[model samples]
Target: MSSRTLPLLFINLGGEMLYILDQRLRAQNIPTDKAKKVMNDIITTMFNKKFLEELFKPQELYSKKALRTVFDRLAHASIMRLNQASMDKLYDLMTMAFKYQVLLCPRPKDLLLVSFNHMDAIKDFVRDAPSILNQVDETYRQLIEMYTALSGGEFQLIRQTLLVFFQDMHIRVSIFLKDKVQNSNGRFVLPTSGPVPCGTQIPGMIRMFSCTGEEVRRLQFPSGGGYTGALREGSFQMFGERVIKLGTNMYSVSRPVETHMSGTAKNSAQHRPAHQQC
Candidate 1:
């Protein structure tokens, strides 16, 4: 925020995690065209000559004109250095770049990032019919937060982003559970009833997918709610030791009809109830 911490925060933005994030985001199939536009617009509007003039006004430590000149120099150097330093950190750098530019220039204008109207922005972004809408929303939501924080606005929760994250995770967990069921090799049993609530599954599911975070080895599900580990014939399989046998009383490894049919045929041939024997 202040001049002192600007470069350090820049280091964080441009540090090791930057490459990892870029690789993951780039590998994801989510469309980046809309997000790129948002990025470009914010950069263009926030960094233009007029905005710089408004931002850098008279300061006690430095003259307004002098401050602007210093900021221009910093801006030019920082922008060039950061851009050349790491492509992965470009967008994150831009968010802070705009903020730094404004503060150094000393302006009263607000940079609008996340707002209540963002729902419409999200709607427009989703209008293109991206298959993974939640992931896309997640990307946008995250982008907005970084930029929003740059402007010093407190972040707000977007429910849709959370919901989409959960849904996508459910699909992935379901696929894994299906494979587990298939591999169970008949020893595996699924509960016929009693499914865990929709939202409750999120925690355990997150734990399952992400174990690298803090204290991952111990996974705890709350008392009242739980997720069934498997789904069969439209019913979710609750995790348990009990297996229900609900079919016929008689169990046959091979064929039940053949056992009776062979005896019946021999008797019928001898008795020659003739009409039906053949």
Candidate 2:
């Protein structure tokens, strides 16, 4: 497990939370000013310099209950509040959405791109508020400086750590089910074929190399699923088009946020240790 996993985890999950909240705010007919304040306040709290300082420190990921507590505070940073049931649903949706994004990444290094997509949305959330936007930009610079320098192996370690953290969580979400991206059992459906990761070749060819480092023979076979060459790599700088769209907000007025906990999650909640109950 990598010590660097927490920041990505937090940012992506926070992004999911924002998406849900934004949609709900609209659905509930929240006053425009009040809705804006809710987004600004949450974004401000999320990107707080002091909080980010602690978040960026090398450390183990928090326990599930502990992490929920952190978001509980952020969700209420403004006058907006959520009941216990609503908060529980929000958390379930956030985790499952991020887990799907992580599992769907074509290459481990693309995780940074996913995080950037989230950051882009976050910056947009407070775009009208210069002060809040500045705060978010600070964290964006920090993310770029910290994660972009990491090697593929380092990213794989971080991805593995996240997978470990999410293992056995199979909460059924209505959006995922409706889109057929998640199965009835709450597992995300991974595509068998698509454009390969940027900077990678399509799978199907094999080349045998000689001892002298010469290509001796080549073989080609059907690469099932109709794969294609990868698109150009997305920008890794502080600002540019992040071609990969895994982390972008999926919720909208047409597709409102909805979640239905799977039996597995419900059972876990019922039998959870008293200390672990959120």
Candidate 3:
């Protein structure tokens, strides 16, 4: 052996652990080369033996007790020291998901419990005597320092935990067809009595005259109809109306009362009610 001490590159927990971690990473679809790398990554930093032991205890993924144990361990182990800023941000991230409990559920049927998603909402664990904790008036500062020791495994642990956290937060993409309504169970069940909103306008398709027809009809009945009828009553032999200006709004001019229709106008006027002329 050389007189110089060589740095140890790995934490030697023996052959069986190495084999099991290699198998687990491969089970997660990691390639043989990458599995070896990640297996090495999992054991070298931030992970103590107890945490790893609890996390991969050979339990089936579908087992309730197993999953509960897994969740409990995950939550416990991932408790990072949050500064006020981080704590505030985490609250904002979870507040909506916490309040309604809408996007999560308790353990259902054969599935793993979604109640684990409410890790932020379990109050008794978080509520007591934190006032004194906050009163410490602790100040945090970012210090630039060179780190000692190897920490290759920390990133993998964080990545894996974050992957699990986000995967649990998934709300399935739902396309509600006509008459679809969501039930109390957060499932798209039962019929609804409403139309889904969508959008409109064009020429020669009833839209040529009106965008929605309501505004057109409102203008027509109150203004166009009234003006046209007024001109008719004024003894005008209207041939056609032509728009003079058509920007922003329309301006039109119509042929006025004929000089020859004076007698007919007088005769028609005699049959009208006094208030109708006004």
Best lDDT among the predictions, by candidate number: 2
The estimated TM-scores of all candidates read 0.16, 0.90, 0.15
List candidate 3 stretches off by more than 4 Å.
1-49, 52-82, 95-103, 106-278
lDDT of 1 by residue, 64-150 (tens): 244334333432221112222232233322223222222221112111211212222333334554443443344334334444344
TM-score of 1: 0.16
Determine which window of 10 residues in candidate 1 has minimal summed lDDT: 105-114
Q: After superposition, how far is residue 158 of candidate 1 from its true place, in Å?
A: 18
Query: For residues 188-271, could you state the per-residue lDDT of candidate 2 as single tens digits?
Result: 888888899888888999999999999999999888877889988999988999899899988754675773323433343334
Per-residue lDDT of candidate 3, residues 42-77 (tens digit):
222213444433423332132324433332232222
> To one decimal, what is the Cα RMSD in angstroms of model 3 from the true structure?
37.2
Taken over the whole model, the C-alpha lDDT of each candidate is: 0.28, 0.85, 0.23
In the order shown, what is each candidate's alpha-carbon RMSD? 30.4, 7.4, 37.2
Clashes in model 2: which pairs?
none
Global lDDT of model 1: 0.28
Deviation from native of the Cα of residue 184 in model 2, angstroms: 1.3
